[model samples]
Target: MSDIIRIQNLQKAYPGFALEGVTFSVPRGAVVGFIGENGAGKTTAIKCILGLVRPSGGGVEVFGKDAALLTAEERGRIGAVLGENCLPENLTAGQLDRVMRHIFPHWESETFASFLGRFSLPQGKKVADFSRGMHQKLALAVALSHGADVLVLDEPTAGLDPVARDEILELLYDFMQEERRSVLISSHIVTDLEKLCDYIAFIHNGKLLFFEEKDALYERYAVVHAPVEALQGLKDAVVAARRGEFGASALVRRDKLPAGTSAERAGIEEIMLYFIKGERI
Candidate 1:
């Protein structure tokens, strides 16, 4: 499938932080989960993709056109939720609808109202009066109402309760039912991504670590609990390890383990923890 969004060696810099040549893509009809530590450049890379931040080097493309050069109509084709109360604070949902109609050529007021109803957001209340979760839902509702072909969501579910989060995920699932629709989302909630994403893109210390199929990532790594001696034999395959009084637990490549060695399945959270904080072999 073709990419709906592409980042080529994306780079950015600040006083203390730098996004160093991070590269990845969101393929058509796929949900790509962006995962990393808080300071690992995920947001910076996202901002670059949306053309909200100017990169010191590299490039981003959306819909086969340079992100930096996308016309207003082309920009309208992408739906973005930036994880903040970014909507007009003083405007009621109804008023915001009226305003957005003028901004987006394809904006659908009925779709927006349906989403508000589904989300239980009051059309008459000002956005500033909404709770955090309400704010998020409104942002998502607006994004989906614009007839966008792709979604760029940063921490979109941050303040939502389980039921609401599930509702949002369901909506996204419905969105992807159409061919060529895609989503790129980042969240601290790994379990959510595990359920919704086809691919996982990991970044660390300003570098792109790996961008791999989620199932293949799980198949490539396993958690082994064995004696220190057994772990020593698998050092080459161990990505990270921890030693305790009884034994050592390590994240290792499944295919590299010696015959008869048993390894348990590893979740995305466990794998991320191993990469970020686990002791290196």
Candidate 2:
């Protein structure tokens, strides 16, 4: 599939923080998860992709054109949910739909109304009176209501409860059934991403660490629990290790480990923790 969004050597500099040479692409019909600790520049990178923030260097491309120079028609094909409270606070849901009709070229009132009903949002109430979770739901409703080919979401499920989150995930899954839609989402919630994403992109300390197929990543990396003596022969294989009183647990590359070296599959969060907090060999 062709790339729907391409970020090449993307760079941004801020006082005491910098996003340096991060590169990744979201293929058409693919859901890509962006993962990182707080202040790791995921949001900054996203902003640059949407042309909401000017990059200090490098560039972003969407639908084969420079993101910053996308025409209104091209822009209308992309939907974004940036934060929990991103919508206008004083507007009622019904009023916002009227406003959005003027904004999005293909805004659908019936679709928006259905989403509001599905999300249990009140059409009569002003947005300022809604809870944080309600804000997220409303933002998502608006995003999906507009005919969008690509979705760029930053912390889209931040304030949602488990059931609501599951509902939203299901909605996204349904969206991808058309086989041409794509999503680029960043969230601290790793399990949600693990469940929904085809690819995972991890950034740490302003750098791109890895961008790989989710299943392939787990297949390549594993956690080995063994006695320290047994682990001694696998130093080269160990990317990160934790030594306990009785044994050592290490994150190892499956290909690098000796034949028959026992290791269990690692989850996305475990792999992330290994990279961020584990003792490197």
Candidate 3:
């Protein structure tokens, strides 16, 4: 299957920060989770994909078209929920619906209404009165109601309670039922991404670290808790290690684990922490 979004050597520069040779692809029908710390260029990459910011170098293509040159129809097929709400704060959901209907040729009022009902969002309340979660739901409702083929969401569940976050995630899963729809979601919530994503892309300090199938990532790495002395023989296998008073925990290639060293499956969060904070072996 072709990629719904392809970013190649994408580069962007700010005063003290830069995205360097960042590259990844979101395959059609897959949920590709973008993972990183704050200010790690996740938002910047998303903006470049949506043509909201000009890249300093390299290219982004969405649906076979250059992102910088997307037509109106192409833009309509992509639904994005960035950090900020684009809807007017003074407008009620009812009013926003009318406005969106005029803006998107494929807008479905019934679907929008269903989403609002499902999310328990108030239609008569102005956006300014809505809580952060409510605002997110509204943005998602708008995105889904337009029959978008691809969804680009940055921190869509940020600030939401667990229950509300789960509800929104379920909606995204439902959206993928068609097998052609794709989603690129960036979140600090690794557990949510762990449950929902097929592939994972990790960024750190404005650099692309790894982009791989989530299952493959799990299969490739293991976390081993062993005494510092045990690590002496496994140096070649260790990616990074954190030494403490009691013991040392290291991220190692599963296949290379030395005899007598027990290794366990590492979750995404643990893996990220190892990559970001642990000392490289």
Backbone collision count in every prediction?
0, 0, 0
Model 1 TM-score (2 dp): 0.96
Ranking, lDDT, top scorer first: 3, 2, 1
What does candidate 2's lDDT look like per residue over 62-149, in tens digits? 9999999998878989999986678999999999999999999899999999999988999999999998778888898898998999
| Residue-wise C-alpha lDDT for candidate 3, range 1-281, written one tens digit per residue | 89999999999999999999999999999999999999999999999999989999999999988998888778989998987666689999999999998998889999999989988888999999998888988999999998799999999999899988998999898999989999999999999999999999999999999999999999999998888777767899999999888889999998888666789999999999999999965
Candidate 3 residue-wise lDDT at 98: 94
Question: CA lDDT of each candidate?
Answer: 0.91, 0.91, 0.93
Model 1 weakest 10-residue run by lDDT: 254-263
lDDT by residue (1-281, candidate 1, tens digit) is 89999999988999998998888999999999999988888889889988899999999999988899999888898999987867889999999999999999899999999999988999999999998888988999999999899999999988688987898899899899997899999998889999999999999999998999999999999999988777878998898988778878999998887777788999998899888878876
* Model 1: per-residue Cα lDDT at residue 184: 96
Candidate 2 lands at a TM-score of 0.96
Give me candidate 3's TM-score against the actual structure: 0.97
Best by TM-score: 3
Name model 3 segments beyond 4 Å from true. none
Alpha carbon deviation, residue 1, candidate 3 (Å): 1.6
Off by over 4 Å in 1: 244-246
